[model samples]
Target: MPVTMPRMGNIHIPFKALFEGLGIDYIMPPPNTQRTMTLGTKHSPEGLCIPFKMTLGNLIEALELGADKLLVPGGYGICRLGYYFKTQAQILQDIGYSFEMIPVGVSERKFLGIMEIVRRLSNNAPWAKIVSSFRFGIAKMNALDNVERKVHRVRPVEAVRGTANRIYARAVAAIDRAPDYRGLKTAVSGSLAELDGVARNEARPMVVGITGEFYVVLEPFSNLDVENELGKLGVEVRRSTFISEWMKFSLFLNPLGINEKKRVQRAAAPYLNRDIGGDGWESVGEKVLHAGKYDGIVHLAPFTCMPEIIAQNIMPHTEEQIPVLTILCDEQLAKPGMLTRLEAFVDLLERKRRVAAGTAKAN
Candidate 1:
């Protein structure tokens, strides 16, 4: 099938591992770039979200690179995502690309759907082999998130601004080489130890929690690598959701008697008691959960993303009283303006910090 899929942050690493272990021919679309965005922007519907545009771009890039089959996540549920595959297929065909689209509808069909896709792609491999491959992929996913979490904690405090990023890239490469859980553990621990060796800085940087749409949260291209930019600004960045952890909870554990979704719902209960579609519930919950810890919250979503728009409106009413900066991205090159807003937000947080410190001294 020469399977291919759009890149989503560190997800490609684990997926690469999965395809290799499945004994299947696979092709990874080239890393996202301005060219990729431009290609998508040229063909995409004007009002579609950034994620949709980027994934379509990724698909086009993959096809250009000789990939003949596409593996896109899908579901039938409370969002437009459910229709992405159908629409995307029509678009690809109209554009004269000859490809097969495999919709892995895990959310709607759950285990059966995933298994069916696996069974088809695995080329009649035994269930035992498929499970082993899946387990290894899951391990790498967890390890990737582990290293990412450390990056979030260490970036702002590193004596050298780019040290954490350098170490993290090496760490991801190491994890990508991991073949088993034991190897994954070694890769994760060794990389984390490397980060621990980064020289320390004296700055007590403000922490910022980033929450919004899942794709923007995970895909750096979609949000302009907000984490690295924040680190350069000496702000510690924490994300509310990790795809690996969420996958473990939602796909594997939830079907077997675990409920991470409910916990997020519980945390957001005071404000939004239900899923408003597409991670809105989690956005609200993250603000409530991290209010006391983060100096502020930054929400990133595509211009027309309704779920995030809903969260954006409700964020101010969150009892936490934490300030929020919501950035709506689109196909346009908005990095310069976004950077300006980020700097201003950081300055505001710093002034608030200084004023609060003076008040504390007076007390």
Candidate 2:
């Protein structure tokens, strides 16, 4: 069976590595584009979040390309994400596509659940090979995250516009093509080096932290490439979510006394004492934790997403030190409007910084 999965940022890179290592034939869905959005919007429920629409489009495209089996993320959660696979499968079936959908319930089952899914997909490969392949995939994910972190930092200061973006793209392709751990490391090192070598301005740029729904934060297409837009405005973006970090916190380190989620949840306790579903608690927690450090926070949420809606309401009540801009993303969100809001917010932060600087000098 040729397996197919939805596109989520550069996650496809690691997924490709894993399936190849396990000797499974898989189809890589085409990159998210206008067509993908249109297909998903046309078929999906009116109130479903943007991630659902986008991933549905991905599976539809993959099925059209002869993929017979679908691998989708699933689990029990407060968010509608838990129900996405079932609804998406039904929609695909109603549209006349014949395929088996496998839900890898990693959120509910954690590491063992993930291992079981890998084993099921591994074509009876030995346990040793399966573990090795999974490790390699994880290594690629970490490498990708590291390279992206560098690119985010370099983008705001690069002397030549788009220099950092070009380097980052090449790095992603190189990482995706890497056949082994050594090659992955080399790709990351070379990419980071290239980013470091980019000529940069001497002036310090305004720094902003991004927090919100996981899908919009990770998938550039869904968020209108907000990070790139912020970079273009000469703002350093400190994003709150990364796939590797999420995996490590949710699967690996939580049991061993290292828990990022718990720490954030503790910080959020004063305001949001309960898990309000999705990343609402984490969203508030991040703002509380990074209050004075970032110049501002850009909260990206899918239109009609309840968790983020709750977060958006509660964020204004939190620490007054940092400004928060909540952007509701959907098909109707236009670039011009988003850019205008971002510009206004950045200008506000700049003015605040100047005032603080002058106050300090006067004192």
Candidate 3:
């Protein structure tokens, strides 16, 4: 069966590597576009979050391209994300598309659950092959994150506008085309070198932390490419989430007696004190934990996301520790408006930084 999955950031690159290594034919959904948002919004309930609408559109497009099966991430949690696949499947069926929907419940079942899905998809492929393929996919994910981190750092300092972003784009394509571990390593090293070689100024840019719902933080389209805009404003962005870190905590570390979630919960104890579902606790925790390290924080939340709504309300209480600017995202949010808000926020941080420096000089 030709399987398909939703696009979230560079996640499709790793998934493509995994499916190919397993000898399974898969069709990647097209990139998220205005049409994607339009289709999803037309079919989805008005109150649903943006991620659901976008992923639903991806499935519809994939099914139309002759894919017979859909692989969607699933779990049971207070967040509506747990039920996304089921809801999307029903919507697709109602739209008259017939296909098998497989919900990979990695959140609850962890590694073994993912292994079972791989076996089913690959027709019981040998354990050795499975491990090898999984490792390659993980390597690609790590490589993507590594290069992305570099791009984030370089974007603010690069002398020429858009140079880092252009190189980062080519890096993603190179990483996607890598066929083995050796090729993957080469792609990462070369990309990092190129980013480091970009001409840059010695100016110290104000650092800002990005925290909020996972989808909006990871998916550029969902958040209006907020990180890129921040970089353009000469602000260094320190994003709180990465797919590689998420995979490690969700799949590998949790089983090995390490509980990163508990650590984050402890950080959030002073504020949230409990998991209100989704990334609410994490959002609050990240702000508290990184309080003085970042000059400011930009919190991106999808419209009507309860977890983030709670976080947004709670974030202001931490203003004494760190300043925050919350941007609510949905189909209605436009680039010009977002840019205007970002510019104002950056200006505020710049003034605040100069005041702090002058005060210290007097001391």
Winning candidate number (TM-score): 2
Tens digit per residue, CA lDDT, model 3, 4-50: 99899999998899899999889999999888899999999999999
Ranking by lDDT: 2, 3, 1
Scored by lDDT, the top model is 2
**TM-score of each model, paired residue for residue:** 0.96, 0.98, 0.97
Q: Model 2 Cα RMSD, Å?
A: 1.1
- Scored by Cα lDDT, where does model 3 land? 0.90
Between candidates 1 and 2, the one scoring higher on lDDT is 2
Candidate lDDT (C-alpha), each = 0.86, 0.91, 0.90
Compared with the true structure, the alpha-carbon lDDT of candidate 2 equals 0.91
> Relative to the unseen true structure, what is the C-alpha lDDT of residue 41 in candidate 3, on a scale of 0 to 100?
94
Which pairs clash inside model 1?
none
Q: For candidate 2, lDDT tens digit of each residue in 1-363?
A: 799899999999888988999898999999998899999999999999999999999899999899989999889988888888999989999999999999988777788887877788776788888888889999999999999999899999999999999999999999999988788889989999999899999868999999999999999999999999999999999999999999898877555777888888888899899999889999999999999799999999999999999999999998545999999999888899999999999999999999999999999
Q: Which runs of model 3 end up more than 4 angstroms from their true locations?
A: 254-260
